[model samples]
Target: MRSDPLIAVEHVSREVTDSTGTLTILHDIDVALPARQSTAIVGASGSGKSTLLAIIAGLDRPTRGTVRLDGVDLFALDEDARAAVRAQRLGFVFQSFQLLGHLSALENVMLPLELLGRGDARARATEMLGRVGLGARLHHHPRTLSGGEQQRVALARAFVVEPQVLLADEPTGSLDHATGETVMALMFEMNREAGTTLLLVTHDRGIAARCDRQLHIEAGRLKPAA
Candidate 1:
């Protein structure tokens, strides 16, 4: 039998109000991200793909809806509780290679470990950097590394915590085709090794094709996969 979905997004919606009045970014979005599988969210820009990803990650609250991560109700939690859940269960990879400029690659990866107060933060960070083939560049800062290298550091950071789910948004958007391919390969390989579920948001059909399933969003609504 198949394992249960690790993420359940139920009737989610996101709206914003400004001078022009209310605008909806996501419309009653409902989907489940299955465990230990690669799933892609694909759509044109502003189609609410990223919004959906953020909500799943507990990075943003839906205007109306409930997101349950591992059967824990995320929306029911206070902000601090939600944040604690995020730190404990979710890992993120972003297009911009979100690393600290002031910190070395090793320090960057050690961040989550440090947050969890893992006593072996340095050792674990070092080992993860080696796994991503950045052992020699561990001391380098973001500005000193090539784009691909920086992205590798990001991958290291995301995997260091060994989270139950990985949330990635256009992780390859900032790199050239060749470099993106390398990083993506490493990402999938690590996910496999860790048995972590992958939920990716991207515009590249090729990348989506690599996923076990695809979620298509159009103008704030999700359509069944063709």
Candidate 2:
């Protein structure tokens, strides 16, 4: 594992069996994401972009292949260890903005830090919310916020811990162009500031173009963008 390569995915494949027989989602995917550099995984729906993100993030396991993050072999770790690694080294943003409707913005942002028993969880959450221009809305619940505001809250929550790698899956998929651009700008800015490696999953060409490198996936195969 290189110090600068925060994430390495080698010969990764994921398969599942349904009544229709075996279906392969990703095949022999190889990627090396360098620290502080932005990388995009672009593909159509069912092209396995989100699946790859999940495997790399340690949220899902591949039937075959290895994922190493910051010198830790994600699959080598047991369930609890993998969870710990994710807690300490990874941050994730999703297309759906998976926030708790019952929790306020501040509480949503504080969840990870509090789980880690960090003493500054509340202060850190408040600062992150403020950084995302949502300081005034910290007490607002998800249902009360607009789509863009909810996404901003998700962004705040993702960056609250300053993890080594940031994984975003269609982060701007729900916003209009202007709002999406603003959200992406904030993401890139925070990545730069924190020196976090960025691995983004998106269908938007504009977003892919802004990354340091682009990868294209089609029918379970991974290839460098043309």
The per-prediction tally of clashing pairs is 0, 0
List lDDT for all candidates, in order. 0.93, 0.90
Which tens-of-lDDT digit does each residue in 69-106 have in candidate 1? 88899988999998888888889999999899999999
Instruction: Give the Å error, residue 190, model 2.
Output: 1.4
Q: Which numbered prediction scores highest in TM-score against the true structure? A: 1
Residue 222 in candidate 1 has what lDDT?
96
* Lowest lDDT 10-residue stretch of candidate 2: 1-10
TM-score of 1: 0.98
What tens-digit string does per-residue lDDT give for candidate 2 at 1-226? 4555778898999999999999999989987777778899988899999999999988899999999887778999899999998888788898889999999999999999998999999999999999999989999999999888998899888888889888999999888999899989988888888888889999999989999998899988997656
